[model samples]
Target: MELHHKLRRDPSWHPNACNICGQLGHQAVNCTNGTINWRQIYGDEAFTIKPPVFWSEMADKQKKKEVDVKELARRAREYARMQCQAQGIDYDEMIRGAQVFQHAPEQKPQLPVTSQQNGGSAGGAVKKEAPEGDLPEGWAVARDAQQRVYYWHKKTQKVQWDKPTKDTPVS
Candidate 1:
């Protein structure tokens, strides 16, 4: 039997609608109202028999999102590299320091604060702490050959690999 003949019409036999042009009677794949014709619209080289109106829309959105994310990530990496170079430190070392911050808890880690030798201000005696848990994923605490510990700071937009001081060696 023919496919249409074997099928029985129901009270809700509403025809398929086209997602692109918002037309009824025929689905987007079989639409012939000139709104979307795969062969003519995309050309023979890009034409495909398989309908991908929904999938293509989703894929396009995903591709755009990925592009935006990659651009942002590239900018951040470049800024980090530049900051590390200015401080006479390895860029990779700074990245490793960011890892330590990533795995730590929400609360900022406490380090000893020393008063300014110039006797600037009492507030200068307290060292401001970095914000907690804002680093990229897959980061870990690592040190360079100099055994310096890296730390991430939002204010400077840098990952600092602090050298061991005379009072606090092996930081």
Candidate 2:
């Protein structure tokens, strides 16, 4: 009992418990077990106990991003131009001109019940004419789904067509 008391009283003896290994006699560094890689083991908690990361080590995740979409698109466009050049195709000539998309015609509103009883529509209302258009220029003969033949007039933008005889079946 005296010897045990003397050992406890010795200067080298550590009264407090070790945070690592939990041994009482020595400091954590003097532990018999190999040094713990707290960063690997405890992860985020390691930062609380250890020296912090250097200022130079900080980074923006966006700077490390894999690809720029605009850059990729520009590269792809260049590649297409190169391929067109290789094939002896004129890039400008190969491109068909852009066309405006036609929207569905707006529906005419129904006459009010009171207006119908009055025997006339509103004074401001007027019927709209459909746009005058025909088959594309240079197209000789146009065929409808029913196989009716059409001749387009470039000047008048009119389609002059022959109606199929009733006896001639469309398939």
RMSD of each: 20.0, 23.2
RMSD of 2: 23.2
Highest lDDT scorer: 1
Q: Candidate 2, which segments miss by more than 4 Å at Cα? A: 1-59, 95-171
Which 10 consecutive positions of candidate 2 have the poorest summed lDDT?
123-132
What total of clashing residue pairs does each candidate reach?
0, 0
Write one digit per residue (lDDT tens) for candidate 2, span 49-152.
56677555545544576588999998987887899899998766555431222344567556434433322434433223322344344334555443334444
Question: Residue 161 in candidate 2 has what lDDT?
Answer: 42
C-alpha lDDT of candidate 1 relative to the true structure:
0.53
Q: Rate residue 143 of model 2 by lDDT.
A: 51
All candidates' lDDT scores?
0.53, 0.50
Candidate 1 per-residue lDDT over residues 56-86, each given as its tens digit: 8998988877757788899999997888789
TM-score of each: 0.23, 0.23
TM-score of 2: 0.23
